[model samples]
Target: MERIEGSGASQLVQLIRAIGYNSEITFELATVTSAPPQLKIKVDHMNVELEKDDLIVAQSLTKHMRKVNLNVKKKASISSTSIDSLYTLTLPQGSGEWSLLSFGLNSADFKVEEAELEFTDELKKDDRVIVVGMNEGQTYIILDRVVMY
Candidate 1:
């Protein structure tokens, strides 16, 4: 009976150890509000991959356009590793109104190798899309963490 209890306790401990903890992050934009754009803009969702072309919507602003900033905050129980050295952000162009934003997180240490905002008219028909990515040889980025606004 004692051995059975000990075995149960060990299994319980093992289960707890196997369960790794996950962090919850709240994304906050420092410059841009989450509110809908004042002007009509197409917001398309796409993943940011290296050397890949993505489609997104374009928004024409009747008012002055402001820079969009992203800020991540960790919950009290969690902490974030420093991303200062690791991550790149890119903007890709897509169809009429839809544009793409790409994020490249360094696989080695999370440093950003390429970050760009772009617009192209070559991929689809008449879509005004924006695409972003790293150069060819800089494929050492791994996207493990992400948040949507």
Candidate 2:
């Protein structure tokens, strides 16, 4: 599988976190029957086409992300501390914040930042970084790979 490194992995993780953690969220691999074949995500009751540029990026990211173990021994509970439109992931080491913007699935975007330097999945705790994706009856959680450090 292709491996995402450096800023690319960080950016992809941010995007996944921006999607938020929802068990009901699902997606499917679809081929657009257009002039040129394209990939699309059938999610959230919508058929959203992936932008050409984004598709290339997603393909690379997904390749690497799929190889990582996304399963957590314990699930982290999601909570909101403020009325703002953002979700926070509180871990034993520290906390990170992310905001989500949804326009169907194609226009979905997320803003995230690198958390405390000590944050990592190797730390035995439930508050590890996770990005969930569902399809049919299957669910997946992509874990953050420590590629930089």
Candidate 3:
């Protein structure tokens, strides 16, 4: 069993985190007669096999992949109001309706205006929706919007 260390291990951890898996990792080595040796990593809900060639390049790439910050400001002309309390809602694409899934409230159908939708093609099942309220009994779905900077 060859020990994987240094940047190789760091890149492996980063890849695991990128896939949204935050749990203990376990590594095991087993000999195979027909195939070349490879690293087998398993975590809850995920399984990965990494060969020696991929691991070498991944180590260098991971070192340079660091987070950077940017300043974001909303356009002045777009009038907006503060949301008192926001809740995340999820609706299946093309369903044409939404049902509130929290606070013991009855599920009701809500409509989303086409102009409010942003990145409609990238939506997935149960994707997050921002819920904003104008006042009690008045709520709106803050769909993805296209704004020109």
Enumerate clash totals for all models, in the order shown: 25, 0, 1
Models ranked on TM-score: 2, 3, 1
Model 2 Cα lDDT, one tens digit per residue, 14-110: 4554566454763222332222133232222235533333332222223222222223233333345555565545556556544453223333333
Query: In candidate 3, what are the lDDT values of residues 1-149, reduced to their tens digit?
Result: 24445454344444545565533432212111112233222122225432333221122212133334433343222223554555655667865655433342234333333333222233222222222222331222222212222
Global local distance difference test of model 3: 0.31
Ranking by lDDT: 2, 3, 1
- Relative to the true structure, candidate 1 reaches a TM of 0.13
Candidate 2's C-alpha runs over 4 A off are 1-123, 145-149
Candidate 3 stretches with Cα past 4 Å from truth are: 1-122, 145-149
Q: How high is each candidate's TM-score?
A: 0.13, 0.17, 0.15
Judging by lDDT against the true structure, name the best candidate. Answer: 2
Top TM-score prediction, candidate number: 2
Better of 1 and 2 by TM-score: 2
The residue pairs that clash in candidate 2, if any, are none
| Candidate number with the higher lDDT (2 or 3) | 2
